[model samples]
Target chain A: MAVAESPPSDPEAPPKVRVGRTPGRLGNRVFQGISTASGIFILIILAAVAIFLLVRAWPALIAAPSAFEDVGFMLGRDLWSWVWPLLFGTAISSVIALVVAVPLSIGIGLFISHYAPRRLAQGLGYLIDLLAAIPSVIFGLWGIQWLQPLVSPLFTWLSTNGATAWLEENVGPTIFTGYQAPARNILTAGLVLAIMILPIITATVREVFLQTPRLHEEASLALGATRWEMIRQAVLPFGRSGVISATMLGLGRALGETMAVLMVLSPGYLINFYLLQPGQHQSIAANIASHFPEASGLGVDALIASGLILFIMTFGVNLIARWIISRRAEFSGAN
Target chain B: MSKRIDVNDLNVYYGDFLAVEGIDMVIEARSVTALIGPSGCGKSTFLRTLNRMHEVIPKAYVTGKAVMDGQDLYGPGVDPVEVRRQVGMVFQRPNPFPTMSIADNVLAGVRLNNRRISKSDAADLVERSLTGANLWNEVKDRLNLPGSSLSGGQQQRLCIARAIAVEPQVLLMDEPCSALDPISTLAIEELISELKNDYTIVIVTHNMQQAARVSDRTGFFNIAGTGKPGHLIEMDDTTTMFSTPSEKSTEDYISGRFG
Candidate 1:
């Protein structure tokens, strides 16, 4: 079995075995080509969408201010001025969604992954997955009909209560002072988005928490650490990046969510800090859906331009998430 | 601070299945005791029962008495956490906290207990514990680096430092060097001998040579069949166990016959 021995010079000697070369099989080449083509197709589709958005939005980018008269908010204002408030609305609502969803997601994730009994964990996991599968339109209907009325009294209390008067007078005159009836405000939209993204973030966080190296957990426990202490030492740190990435994904969904915000938020075009006020905020996706039917000429292009802005923001958020995930890879202990 | 352990009629089980049955033995203080057996013989399960670490697995429980210093470890009022604080364990793999710095990892056992030490005292403890594990000289310059930055052997030593930081009375190592290279295994064996001066140590090893090299006393475990529970075949001084074991099965196993 000498691999490197020279081949015999005899005419009857058998062919020497070649160890390194793989036979060129048709099936292998076909499979490799299909997978490579599929990967490139995704990038091509992404680029094509970007190109389409830019081409469709070019007319509004250079249109005269007078051309926007049909769209009441952009009558005399340039595109940037009209879009800035929408951009603010998008950011504020999504930030609220993130701030609310992250802590709750971590709690629920840990409960399912570590705290729940074996039978209960499986049942709760399925329930959360079902929540994620519920349609956005159904959530929109539930938000407008159910959640809006339920939360109106709390907003009214904050606006008119004696205990909150000081907060309105000294701290947030614009933010907490104004309260409109029916509770169809940006804050309500944010709350609905929070509910929408809860299951998504919880699923990711729970999966990462469950995947924590059991040895690290035992190491903590062997040090006489309590259950909470063991989670603090081993579970939380390991799932930190996972939580951030999950938050970013939720942010992306919130930024582009149309039905819930459109149905829950009363439309307005203004840059203000009045979170509870009905006629003070409007998100870009909601704005486009509401105006697209009545828009004409450059008005349509203007809405698309606004969509381009939202597209860039979500893309940027995803890029940041990827960077954070890769940066933490070195010490993730998963190696 | 080292303490002896005495066990009687210990039976380990996972749910309805018994894993290790009818074990009775005494482990002397300030000495190394090695348990050698083939895979699935439940030697590691028996080791975990000493500190109640077996109960960490859902439905895995132990029945019997493991007494140390006139206290039954499995007594009704005793906390498993308190037992683990006295009896520390090292797993087969080296697992350092990935997010912690080298200095922080060395202090993990103390810090995780919610103990507050002053800055100077914390620094002194880190240096002393790392030195005790023979890792201070190699890592003193980069205390701020992550624990995973070290080589595998260094990380294992760092785990040893983390364990000893709490000043446990007994150390249980379950095949601590099975994943390591020969030189690393030698270093761990030498460290084990030095460590016996401060802590009662019980180690489960698949390698009989490792048992012969480091242990003062040895126990051989064997299983009757695939589904039957494992039991201790024989226990004696390491020299006698390797040279003139009383059980026929122990001799056959040691002589590389059927295990």
Candidate 2:
């Protein structure tokens, strides 16, 4: 009825309802469409990359001589070799990096956020962040030229007196049969990775720690708690999930790191537990980097297959980190 | 375990800035002393000094002495942590540890000190403290629930329970009922009266009616001008202070003439 009445009004009068000519309305819709398109575009690009990797990797697996001995298996070598050693090396080195980085990051984060005076904290925080800006190749070069020489004595001592002694005493000499202590090894590679990732974890965790409410800290102090006790009771509990996600972020970087591991570690095919020794393990990214230029025919497909695996591993680490963060959301009260 | 507090010529400062100056008062044992003042008059600052909580702020310092029982709280060898343990505090806003449960919140003061309690003893202490705060029946069945799940007034009472669980000689409250509704404010006022029988209570409040209703003695604090340090204007019995305050500023402040 209203529409019929409006049509009967004077023809010279402006229309009762405004059309799509309003700049504010048109601009808002256009901006919204752009944002939605950008989000969808990102998803499409990610999917395309995944599908491309999977399609390229399929030929290497299907061309294998046997089903059980193909690229499907993680432990064999006959043209389409298994990825067990690369996977093992990646896992162990990244795990070692996480073990070394997490505690040290938390300690540094706490010192910067809570313990240090304001000016010192600012200066220390800036210095730590500068570490993240250093190029990966530079870290690799430093690890090889300087870090290796410095750690050689410590590595020699460990091989003679540390876990090496216990392993030889209990498990026998079979394990160390082919082990050779080279200057570059998985341990050195992992140590370099740890230093590379420390800044990321420390920066993230320190921001989280700083976000802890002042009231909670004051409440803990007013309860007769010591400074350390107050931190444990309030700051640590509040930042627990943040710490987990920060460590996972560092782990993700360590897992896919190519150049630094390549420069520091002497690559080999077999997985060896003698981390202090050299010529033992080869991470997937480092292997792919070193082999990609010379690779031909199915060899390229094999490198892509290894790349696919590394991608999945890093993706899984990030997914788990997100899950842990969401699970802790209810208790964190950060909302 | 109540104790009298003797504050002599107290001066509080944050670095070069004096926050409050020349506060001398005798806070009797087993009674409530209400500090009533306008905002920025440093009533809360003076209350925090009683527990050494003011110095928690960076560069904050206090001079003079607060003698509790026979011990000087500001003595060179005295530990602030020990002073805090002896004199507990409830803040303007209820700040229950969001990560802790109701039971754990009550036990925080004891547990944070690294003093272990038997399971049965912990349960008993929780029940006793909750009962003292008048929050036992409402929360007893849901002791495992997070403390943040409670209403604003309930959270404040839970904080009170946590403070009293340590069995402090004195309890300092900085406008404990300011964030509550009228009914909750009345409930806390009643609780304060009951609490004074066991603990020497010092409360800072902007509410004159609350001061009149709950306190045995009332101290009025006022600032001279902007950027000037706050000072205590007068101290007297609650009845005298409300009806016939010695200072004109106290009379003006109490009667809503001016801050």
Candidate 3:
């Protein structure tokens, strides 16, 4: 059988190849290149920003403020003196926010997805989404003006009686100020942060819950499950990983929140465990926002260092979230 | 443990649109009754009403009476949940809870009802139910694995196991083998024969041969025209219905004349 070969390479004659452009292929290649370049550009910008923050923080990290002479740890001596307190404050407040936000968010999500009437469900979902659109600064103002006053009495009572008295007796007086000061405190800031992150967690969880396959829901119902029982048996188990990821997303937001914490909490340099006492704590983001404008060489670098820490924290949270999701993917049937 | 079902002048509606009208039949205790019909004939809808599952659909409602052992399922103050507990159902698709283990899937119905079962009792019930469904030998070693890890046939069997674990008096199966292969379909048919010894079984199928092979009684449903409500054309002993149906439409449907 004679094989049809490409037209014998005519070197002299006009090429039979017809190398004229094909718009579809050329456009596809151009679009592919554009997309790849954009992706790499994002990575480059992220790396550049991270490197810039590190370089700016280095000088302050090595300066060793006068207060560092009293501290003995190697890294503590080299880093800014207030770094530990700020780190502690950041972690505690964010954790407090998570503890407060997760349950409330899951409850709201379940109510909207499973219990509410169709029209009311839609309206409630939209209203919750609208909460996410509210600016952080506005939340800060609300926390300071309205929420602080509303909850001040409770804070005062808690600090004076209940667990606070027991904690003071056991842990010592130096640790807590016992609510003698104003209501602007880490507890208030954490509460505001919880409110700020609630919408995000609720929306993500609601979407996940809604995606529970109708077939599984029917299966549960056919097994004689009540509405709440069906949710527990089918919907909750199906959405477990989604809820964890959503909580992590909220935690990430809470970790980076600046304006709300800065506005609501009365900042201090000393490390204190009394979260209900005002003028006892300072979160890294809030400290940076408060001190950055007036800060000098070392102080500015210190702020940048704290910013770098915050970035690492959020990154760590996202990574852990991804790990948890991937680990549960096997049984979740979400793969 | 099985109970006879009496359905009288039943009419099912989705909002104002009647889907199935004037369905009257009796499903004898401890027998497999097969509902055979063409697509869009409301056979599945009629089957769903047996366990009050039809009303779970938005705007769906049913009229008339379906009584089991002299108790009206739709009587005033009769709880749908209680009715469903006594009348278990299997669907066309195999939907074992994807997140639950094989053993857990079997126990789901009982546990979901908040019934307290001792560990030994639960283990015994799981083995018994799985064995009864003819799936124990295949899945006994992997009871801890996710239910979704099983094949299509195995999952359907697991669903049957789940239903029987609740010890329902009647089992409603809607095309339990349509999605399965020929071999799996045969397996399910054999299992249905065994299941009917303990539970009243009502199954809806499009496969006429399946009805001929497994059912003691057969029902043929048909629609008058497009957008018209479906109604039961004829129901009789399976052998008589397949060989000498009373209605021309039943004969035409069983003889493959037209849907």
Candidate 4:
């Protein structure tokens, strides 16, 4: 049994002092701390952005002077009027991206981890890591040039024959819908986002799959199990939480992705359930990124205010993902 | 009744390192055979070679024939999967699947192989397998809990239950009771003796008395050098191996003269 030796920190615990500062045991950690200043500075900058956003958006946060019909107290425009559409689009598109990305990413991770030869697996892992490290702006530029035509043929085929009766009724009335699709739409944006985030999820999942105990696998194989069977029983169930955490990490990125969505999705102000509709349904990040450069009057406050909402949303998502990652070993438990 | 193993000039290797060399022994069906040696003498490696469990590592290979009844086990037509199905193994360390419940751990081999048995039949298999490993009464009420939740000894028994669930002809146990407490160790020893009544049991252990007490026959393997591998020194009836005759190295090992 693994007893919790300290329920919390034990009150009777002896006082301790830093080992590096001790007379005889001084080491390289102290020397390294001096050169790591830039690393420390980056954390401070992240903190500064959060604090600045908090302080600047406080007026809308406290309450609008007009006491606007803002449900979220987002500056000039009422919250429901402006924030909801962007928030909805951000959530819907990211979720759709997650739904598309997760299974395929896991499949890719599984293929590379279990199915590939050693050198090939290593090469694939490096490739995926390189893809993940590529700057977001590059993917956004690529998406604009690449994603539109990629999805056009499939969209055209589906609207033409796949949904014929529904298409016949709605095609003429909504010409820019799937029937006369302009191609740069929510799904196109989502597919692009899915591609961008695939590497991140796959890396996280692949590492987890790799960490599965060799002994458990050997035990399975010795019991007359085939390779696939060994993985299904021993590797998959053990790595399920790891895969969930990885997918959620990618979802957090997808939620806040700005340049790609803004470029690929021609931003407008209509909210429609039809995913293929060629219209403007902006994301929170894209809204802030596009509007912040030239802002005046209440629009500045509104933009900053919306940015605060987004910052909070992303923070909440990240917090949950961390919680999930931390609890993963517990869910799998110790073998 | 299905088979007996005759290992002749057997050698075990992990990459370029030959871990065990020139082992010659016969393990009788429906009886207990113990391989005992000091740490790093390659006793466990030889045990692993009996069912080809050591082949899991990339670059790990072996030479010479391990004949089971009529067929050479390492021959071209023989399948490692089928060999493993017939000759199951328990590791030096207990390894029950952490994500599965105790009942599910017992059913893992059958379930993963897509062997369909009714849920009631699965329940019966769980009980019988656990009973076979001498773990059922202790774990019966908590069969639904995760296998990792069990105490170390119970977890080891769960692994043993998992090994026997498919009902193999031979059981290869590599220090199966090494990590257990005396009570658990006693339980496993009892379980081994009972299992030998029906299955050909080959166990490897550094515990000298364990080999003397449980085995019908004992084989001694001794290592020579840093680069060179261990060789099987002698095999005889357990009574003679412990009491009077054998190789000087075997006598030195058992009498605590030298490793």
- The candidate with the higher DockQ, 1 or 3, is 1
lDDT of 1: 0.90
Task: Give the better candidate number (2 or 3) by lDDT.
Answer: 2
Task: Tell me each candidate's RMSD, in Å, in order.
Answer: 3.0, 5.3, 5.3, 7.6
Residue A50, candidate 4: alpha-carbon lDDT: 89
Off by over 4 Å in 2: A1-31, A65-81, A162-167, A171-181
Judged by TM-score, which candidate is best? Answer: 1
lDDT of 1 by residue, B135-201 (tens): 9999999998899999888899999999998999999999999889998888899999999999999
- Each model's TM-score for chain A is 0.91, 0.86, 0.85, 0.78
Q: Spell out the clash pairs found in candidate 4.
A: A268-A280
Worst 10 residues of 1 chain A by lDDT: A4-13
TM-scores for chain B, in order?
A: 0.99, 0.99, 0.99, 0.96
Q: CA shift at A119, candidate 2, in angstroms?
A: 0.8
Better of 1 and 2 by TM-score: 1
Kindly report the docking quality category of candidate 4: medium
* Position B168, candidate 4: lDDT: 88
Give the candidate order by descending DockQ.
1, 2, 3, 4
Q: RMSD of candidate 2 to the true fold?
A: 5.3
- Candidates arranged by lDDT, highest first: 1, 2, 3, 4
DockQ of 3: 0.62
Across residues A92-126, which tens digit of lDDT does each residue of candidate 1 receive?
99988888898999999999999999899999999
